[model samples]
Target: MAAPLDLDQLQTFVMICDTGSFTRAADEVHRTQSAVSMQMRRLEERIGKSLFEKDGRSNRLTEEGERLLSYARRLLHLNRETLAAFDDRSLEGQIRIGTPDDYADRFLPEIMARFARSNPRVELTVICEPTPGLVEHIKRGNLDLALVTHNDARQSEVVRREPLLWVTSANHATHEREILPMAFGRPNCVWRRSACDVLDRMHRDYRVLFTSFSATVIAAAVLSGLALSVLPECALRPGMRVLGESDGFGLLPDCKIGIMRGHTANSEIVEALARHIAESLDNISVPSAEEAPAFDLAALSAMRGRRHKPANLMPGW
Candidate 1:
């Protein structure tokens, strides 16, 4: 077996990678530059390979260094979790969670509120971002757990998926001419791609009238009829309603929701938090078109009809 590596040295290496400079890493780790250098030297000797490439002014990780970075991050996270568990098995510790913008905006607040009522002593910190970014943060050990869409072939390994629905304004004019416009998320977003694929396969002509990275912005746009977009049932709002049957639109493939753990070694509090989050999400209601406001496509067309506006049309026209 390979010799056991020093956890402190690995921590130093991780700090260096995160901060990208020894001077900064030393400041963060509360060690002098020379002492930090000594730790690295000793670590390198133990590993029998240079972890970083130092040219006059710039510092970069060697290939071995890059490989070690991933392992070191996981190790440090495990170490922290281990210490936290020994300190307290009761769910009264800080839990840092990362969620997608839409999930954070619509569903997380209520679920977290319930959790807070039950565990008043536990501190919760939530970070919101796109699924890809959240996944990266979890992998980097920056978050104890994250809710995100899965990517790649390892898709089913760490993901739970739910059906999505298309929604639009309840009022519309031309049943045949209603060119559905929509506001969507950034390119890397799963919902955006799924919605577009379904429309294309159905031979439905639609246009993306606007795009925004924020979930709130997309919801606002949909309400204003700036465009129609597909979202999960949990996100349906007062003015927003489902457009079809739950399965009317075939399963939008499976947009995976990843539940990642920072470390499994000794993170009882965090594990409890993860379990709560997963259970809460799984229990959320999935509404169908019949359960939602009924749309009168033909009546909607007559109510406030949509007409094709040419590019050169006058501002008020």
Candidate 2:
């Protein structure tokens, strides 16, 4: 029988495909250029097919090599995951996770701090974006997990919905803008939609005075008394106060927080990570109605509308 395929040889092959140069691949794998060529020749002999085709001065994967590259990536991923699982609590593997920016700053830091207190060996890669982008990454398997606000068809078995709260300046009279000016995020943002829908349903005429995807910009707008914003209660701070709770305003729908697992049984690192996240959120002090801001519709409807709604208010939306 043919000798079992060598993992080192397959890895070298992948490096060659990545760099498109045996010399460069050799430098990366710490082998001589001739040694690298010899390894590839042996790999092709064992597999019964040439791995690459030489065209002019460039090297490209042969049809068979292209097919092998896919399996090579899978094998690498599986091998890494398996080793991580067998290793002790020293969870020293790369984890790519995505979440909304609001959560990244307000919620994730605390969770990560707590997790790191225990698993100092683990390395984390975090990407902060809106729900749509995060979901796309999860579907592409580029992210090990993501936290997103649940939407209609995007809702999954791995989702958790957190209550969203409407927040405005402390006193309606202090901020004398009749048309409840809103500081909004991109259209895909659930918080922005919730804020707009609440105003529309109540027959409140409002204008989005400032728009941005950055949480800092939205927070700054609200703090400067330029506009009001809807955010999670836990996200509120002294600079940005909540509206009154006794104003009889309708509460917006809960913001969905999802935790997706790309591989359920592949690695304990993922499970430990999920567990750490859950515990972190569970221990947080969620905002209650008493802590929510008050809203006055009669006062809000008095402001004037913008000259125009500003066409294409959201660029990518």
Candidate 3:
């Protein structure tokens, strides 16, 4: 019979795919680049197929490597789950976690549900604040974990990424205005500042019509047809339509979501929670830019002419 696949090797493989570089995967796996290369060589030999091919200076997965990736994740996840079932270090007591309100609304449900299933004895305490506040809480050891927008140079493990898109209410032609109306977060918010800077570079006519720290308030403004906002794909809702280059709004940077653990936190439980968060976010992506339809402003303008309408403005912080 064929020998069982090595979990460590598979894990290294997955990390390479996740990080898109051998050097990064080496750092993540705590192995030297040479050692990581050796592991992949052995893995490829065992599978009897070349797993990666050179694309310029970088490694691109071969068809065989892509096929192994899903299986590798499943195997590693199952391995973790099996060990957790018998581990005496199962989580108990209270775990304090923090996240921005926007993330708490969009991402907490999955993270919480997965966590609750594995550590039912643990009581979870959640705090909703902006990323800066959450970072402070984690740094002070007041929070055991924090989900944050990964922009600043900080100690964080980025777990998920998706496109940041321009958004406006589907029912309104508000985005068609001569001077674009916008809703944004607090003054210090990164997304708000970045979006404004990008608009300025494009020489777009826009006004920050509303400013609120609350994502709910900002979303309310957007839905009311008063303004346009920038948001990650996951936070999109039914009444919202994505705007693109066709709308004169240029592409924004990818939104990166990460987990930060407290400086002094429960090692076992915190690590477990982090793994669940990462796994839940894995292998997901927003549709490619090539797939976005060319939007027509004239249609929205025509629809606006028929509206006896009220006005409004909007989040990722």
Candidate 4:
């Protein structure tokens, strides 16, 4: 039989595609850039095809690389699941998790569900808070793990870096108004700070029309055309339009979603949960700029027609 493909190399391949650069992929896998490059070269030689091609200063996946991505993700997930199945069942503890409402709604359900299924006795206490507060909670030992948005590259293991978009309801003319009206979370919210800072730097006049800790409430405000808000690409709904420079809104910085752990988070359970979070994020297919038009207002209206109701709000939990 042919020798089995290495899972570690497969993971490196997937990371390279996800991050869009060999350097970023190296940072993610905690390997030197040369090491990652060598590994990929070997992988290509073994498979007898090029996996990547130079696209300017960055790398783009070749056709073969694209086909292998899905298979690699499935293989990694199955490998982890199989290992977890044989893990010691005696591991049990209450794990306190903190995350922003946006991430909670988008990624937490599946993460928590899989964790619960695998470790039935491990109790989960999830807290919904802004990223700053979540970090503080982790530092104060109030949370075992936290998913936060930070601009600092050295903060934690970055799961994803999504472009921050200025979104408004397609039916609403809020973006056309003078002195842009904005809706955002309360103080200490990263998106709120980022929006305000950019507007200030650009000398743009804007007013805070609504403030809510709940993402659903903010979505409702935007959906009703009450105000425009800055959100990550993943948080955008089908019917929401992304504003750009042409739309009179300056570019916003990308939001880095990272996994943070408390000082006391040294248990196997904590590590397992972290792995799950990373894997879940890795599996998400973020659209490339070329694939998505900056302002596709026509499609927005269609998406709005079938928008699903927001998940249950978990404020101050």
Candidate 5:
């Protein structure tokens, strides 16, 4: 009987495909480049097909390799789940987690739900705050783990870089205004700082009409046609429209979301929760420039013409 494929070999293969180079994969797997190459050779020999082909200086996955990628991911995921299920199920401890309101709203629900099922004995305490506050909590050893937005990638294990968007109410002509009115969260918020810095650098005339710690309040302010706000693309709502160059607005800088561990030593439970958060976030797809929708000034103008009266410009706060 033919021998079954080794999980280690499959792991190496997947890493190579993901990293797009044997050298990088070797670094990730803690193996020498030659060792990684030998593993790939043995894997191809067992499968009776070449998994990769040389495309110029880079190696591209073959059709067979492409087919195996999906299976490899599923098999690896299942393997991890099985191992975790058999691990010390009795392990119990408290894990304190911190995150910005935006990320907490988008990702924490599913992450916490899955974690609750897997680690029923583990107690979780989550704190929602701005990125700066979360970072402070982590530094003060008040939090076991934190998810935050930072300009520096070296600050933590970066989960992803999310594009910032200039969002306004779809029903309002706020984008066409000469001096833009904007809403932001707290003064120390990353989004608020980025928005103000970009506007200042661009020499744009803008006014901060509202400041609130609650994302709901900020969203309500935007939806009420009182102001435009800069937000991570994922935080944008269906009723909001993204402004682009055509809308005569300067582009906002992207923000990197990272995972930070508290200064206090992490227990096994804390480490496990951090791993889960990282994996969950890594699985999310960041929108490409081509996929992002641009602002339609013509449409906004057309809608404005049909409006019988101007929108209320008062701050929601």
Candidate 6:
């Protein structure tokens, strides 16, 4: 039988990948640089893969290293979770969590508040990427938990549902245009596909005015009279008006919110956080009567003017 991979070596591998220096990784992990190199050599022999190759003055991950990274991260995460689960003491580690940009503003505050209060010792690191990106993160063990827009094929827990609404600026008549101009997510966004499919069926003359992965970017366009957009109920901001069948818009299917967890997300605190997320979303009495906080036009304009754009979606996303 093949020998099991060493947790210590895997941790070293991940540390080297993160810090981008063998010497730095050795210092952090309390090992001599030669010992670190030896660990990597043993790991390569065990896996029969050349994980890294020297490039000029630095070492870069070989294709095999990239593949092993995901597995290494998962194994390390699961090991930590397992130890934490068996311990009698309160959980005390950082949890990496993820959500779509659209859900971050609407759902995170309350959920984060609840989790922090309940698990004071546990640290939370949040990542805001779209659903497909979050899925990739989960697969790569970059995130321990994720809240995603649920669909039939995704392997996640559907925790809540809300209407997908057509929204326009209350102060603008953008939706009334003869050829409807719309702001939408990338082509793979489920909401974008739905909106496009409905428009095609109705033979509605519509053109995509803006394409972005950031919900806020799209929301800015919607609120500034730049275009119309379809967003889930929670994404509605103040000064946005909903369009319905009465406004010549077709019906859209309900949006389902889901929770994605690491394959080995069995730690007590992880489960506790999942419960908090579900309870928070289920108790929507707080947000139902009000819109999420809005970014004013000036702020959004500045955001657009910045050279830094939102992260690009992964390939095939």
Instruction: Supply the global lDDT for candidate 4.
Output: 0.77
- Per-residue lDDT, model 5, residue 248, is 66
> Order the candidates by lDDT, highest first — what do you get?
6, 3, 4, 5, 2, 1
lDDT of 6 by residue, 210-258 (tens): 9999998998999899999998877878877777766777778778899
Which tens-of-lDDT digit does each residue in 1-317 have in candidate 5?
87987899999988876666788788999999889889989989988998887665556777788778767765776577667667786457788999877788778886897677667678989999877788788878899888888666337787766667788988899877889899998887777988899889878899999999778788888888999998775576657777766666666667678888886665788778877787667555433334434444453343334332322121110
Assess every candidate by TM-score. 0.55, 0.58, 0.72, 0.73, 0.76, 0.63
Query: Which model is ahead, 2 or 4, in terms of lDDT?
Result: 4
Best TM-score among the predictions, by candidate number: 5
The 10-residue segment with the lowest total lDDT in model 5: 308-317
Best by lDDT: 6
Model 6, backbone clash pairs (residues 3+ apart or across chains), number: 0
Between candidates 4 and 6, the TM-score winner: 4
lDDT agreement with native, every candidate? 0.66, 0.67, 0.77, 0.77, 0.75, 0.79
TM-score of 4: 0.73
lDDT for each residue of candidate 2 in 1-317, tens digit (9 for 90 to 100) = 75778889989988876665677788999999889888989988988997777665556677798778767765764465456556685666678788878788767877787666556677888998877788788878888877777666774434344546655665443234557788888887778878788878877667888888777788777777778787764566554554533443455666667677664333677777776676566456544444533433322222112111221111010
RMSD in angstroms between candidate 4 and the native structure over all alpha carbons: 9.5
- Which lDDT tens digits does candidate 3 get at residues 183-262? 98878877888898889999999999999877888889888999999876666666777787666777677778899998
Best of the two (4, 5) by lDDT: 4
